[model samples]
Target: MTGDQLLIFLAGIVGGALRVGVPFLFVSLGECLTEKAGRINLGLEGVLVLSAMVAFGGSYLSGSPWIGVLAAAVAGALLATLHGLLCSLPRVNDIATGIALMLLGMGLAFYLGKPLIQPQAAQLPAIPLGFWSDSAAVRAALQINALLPIGLLLAVAMWWAFASTRAGLLVRMAGDSAHATRALGYSVSGIRIAATAGGGLIAGLGGASLTLFYPGSWNEGISSGQGLIAVALVIFARWSPLRCVGAALLFGGAGAIGPALQSVGIGWGYHLFNIVPYVLTLLILVITCRPGVIVPGSPTELSSNK
Candidate 1:
């Protein structure tokens, strides 16, 4: 490939990393908080889908993208709360509850989003950073999403809170040892429920970004399993909030390979390139999940350990 083509491809990947990584970043950070509280909510896929629809619908009705984002967060929190409540019951598995909720969320979204399929809602504004470059491709690549910085700041905030707050200590204690948490006079279930709800709220923003910024649309197929993949991403990051940022950008870059190549007039193996992110996910999981090898930061009560 020519130097100009190579530069364009790289630029596209970088831009895509910032763009696509916004959702992955939010979702992974949310899952990290949830898992840190001794509970796993795989229903994030459901949360993501439902929020996307709600966000779009709200934007269309209210003529305000911000309100749509708020609606999405509320919807996501409600669904996540239901998952927490069900799992709190005796003998109810968190993973199983998540699976059910995932299906439920998707079904509800599909049924409710039929009308949204044709509507054009207001989208979040983009920050243009490409004026320095004369090339149209470069200009397009530099149009970063406004939510990206917000997600980054949120990640930093979460990491700090997890490392140095009273609530953070309680969450860690509950995840590591339920008995210890109980001895400290804390309700383990309450902590987990709160964390799950908060996580869902954050994940909802990711859904908002998906519909209101990047893809800029409301559709059943918009998510494309990003919510599910985020579970693996959290694992890959070893539950570190800061690492989640890097992992998300990496996943975004992997996802951009196909489109980047195609943009440069290299269409061969486009389909194969499209699967890079998934392939990378499997590879990361395989490498990290070794028999008899415990993940250092993983919650003790996580179902994977049990």
Candidate 2:
């Protein structure tokens, strides 16, 4: 391949990492927060699909993508909050409740999103960063997702909070030892529900980014199982919010492999390349979660719960 084509392929991967990985970053961060509180909600797939629909529909109706993002966050929080509440009930299993929530979320989205399939909604604006270069391919590759900085800031905030904040300590304590939390007179369930809802709110933004920024559309297959993949992503990151950022970009880069290959006329294994992210997820899970191996920085209650 020519050097120019190689540069284009590399640029495509970098661009995909930013554009496609934004959703992963948001979702993984959300999941990390929820797990830190010692609660697990696996219904994030439903959250993504439903919020994507709501975001698109809201943008289409209001002529504002920001308004659509707000709607998506609200919808995601509601669904996640429901999961939190249900799991609070006696004898309720978090995993089982999460699965049910997933089904409900998808069902609702499909029913409500029927009309949104054909409508063109306002999309989130992009910030061009490749103006320094004259090449069209480089310019396109460097257009930053408007929401990328927000996700980065959130990661920094979460990491700092976990390290220095009183509330962060309390959440970590609750996850590590319910007894310790109760001894301090805090309601375990209350903290967990709050975390789960907050996490859902963050995950909702991931959904908004998917529809309003990257692919910039609403569809049944838009999420493409990103929600479910996020669970493994959280584990792979070992619960660190900052690490989640790196992991997300890695997944994004992996996902970009197919298009990157095509960009350079190496399209014979396009289908195989598309599965790279999933394959990477499996490898990460196996490596980090091997039998009898204790992953560093794992939440105690979360491990026991699983």
Candidate 3:
């Protein structure tokens, strides 16, 4: 490749990173919050699928992308809330409940999304910062959706909250030891239920971003386990919201490798390129899972690190 061609390839990578990272950032942040409350919701994959369906259907029906987002959030929260209730019950295993919820979410999404398969909905508008750029390459590179900045800002805000705020202290205490939180006159289950619900809301929003912003359409296959990947990202991030953003971007960039390569007329190994993100995730898991490796900023109560 010539110098200009190499630059173009580099630019494509940057654009791809933003395109891919937005969903990861949102989902990982959600998972980070949920995990901090000492519960794991593996049903996030189902939540994403269901949220995407609801967001698209709601937007298509209401003629507003924002409404769809709200609908998706509500759907996600409902699912998470259900999971929270089930897991809180005596003799109910959280993991089993998560699996059941995942199935339920997928079934519901598929059943309700049947009518929305072909109907076109209003898509979210992208902020065209790239339009101001004189260079075509620069313009293309900057033509990302607005959600990227929003997700990053939220990550920073969440990090600060978890580290500095009184509520953060309480949440950390509750996650680390229910007994400790109870001794402090706090309701541990109640706090966890709230956290899980909030996590669901964010995850649902992430699904909306996928349908209304990135791909700009609602389809059954819109999400290919991105929600599950976000769970992995939370572990990789050590439950830090800020680190989740970085990890999300990395994963997103990895996910974009195939498309980016194809865009530049490099398609010899395109099929293999699709596996890059998953491969990278596995490598990260191996490295991060070392015995006695300190997860310096993780919530003390999280089971993944323990």
Candidate 4:
């Protein structure tokens, strides 16, 4: 490839990373929050799809993207709360509950999202940060959605809050050992419930970003397992919010492989490119899941440690 061609290819990769990273960022951050509180919600895939449908429907009806986002967040929180309640019950398996919630989320999204599949909703507006660039390559590289900045900001804030604040200390304690937290006169289950709900809200907002901002439309297949991948990303990121952003960008870049290849007139490997994200995810898992690698950061009471 010529110099200009290589530059264009790199620009496309960057654009793709920005475009696809938003969902992963939101979901990974949400999962991180939930995990910090000593619980896990694997039903984010369903939450994402349902939120996308609801956000689109709200936007379609009210002609207001903000309202749609709020509605989607509420819906996601409700679903997450349900999962929390079920998991909190004695003798209930959190993993099984999460799987069930995932199935339920997908079913509900499919049923309610049918009408939205045919309609076009108002898309979230983008802010161009690259006006200084006269070249097409520069412009494309800088054209990013607002969520990217928001996600990064949230990650920084959350990391600070979790590491430096009193509330963060309590959350960390609760997740590390529920019995110990209770011994210290803290409400373990209560903390987990609140965290799970907040996580759900963020995940819902992430889903809304898909319909209202990124793709700018609602459809039955809007999510495509992005939520599940986000869960994996949290593990790969070692539960650090800042690391989540980097992991999201990596996943997003992998996802851009097919389009980037096509742009360069390489069509035969399109299907192979589609698997890049999953392959990268697996690689991350293998590298991060060593016996001692993730243990230092993981909640001590968490079952995944075993």
> In order, what lDDT does every prediction score?
0.90, 0.91, 0.82, 0.83
Estimate, for each residue in 1-306, the C-alpha lDDT of model 1 and write its tens digit.
998888788889999888988889988988999999998999999999999999999999999999999999999899999988888888898888999999999999999999999989999899887778778998898789888989889999988988999998888877888889999889999998999999899999999999999899999998888899999999889888999999999999899888889989999999998888899888887987788777777888774533
Q: What global local distance difference test value does model 2 have? A: 0.91
lDDT of 3 by residue, 121-154 (tens): 9877776656754668756665687667778888
How big is the positional error of residue 281 in model 2, measured in Å on the Cα after superposition?
A: 1.0
Question: Which candidate ranks first by lDDT, i.e. highest?
Answer: 2
Off by over 4 Å in 4: 135-142, 290-294, 304-306
Better of 1 and 4 by TM-score: 1
What local lDDT score does residue 147 receive in model 4, on the 0 to 100 scale? 63
Arranged by TM-score with the best first, the candidates are 2, 1, 4, 3
Candidate 3 lands at a TM-score of 0.93
The clash count for each model shown is 0, 0, 0, 0
TM-scores of all candidate predictions against the true structure: 0.97, 0.98, 0.93, 0.93
> Model 2 residue 174 lDDT?
81
The deviation in Å at residue 50 for candidate 1 is 0.5
* lDDT of candidate 2 over 1-306, digit per residue (tens): 998898889889999998899999999998999989998888999998899899999999999999999999999999999998998888899999899998899999999999999888999999898887777987888788888999999999999999999989988988899889999999999999998998999999999998898899888889998998999999989899999999999999999989888977898999998999999988988888877777888888976744
* Overall local distance difference test of candidate 3: 0.82
Error of 2 at 200 (Å): 0.3
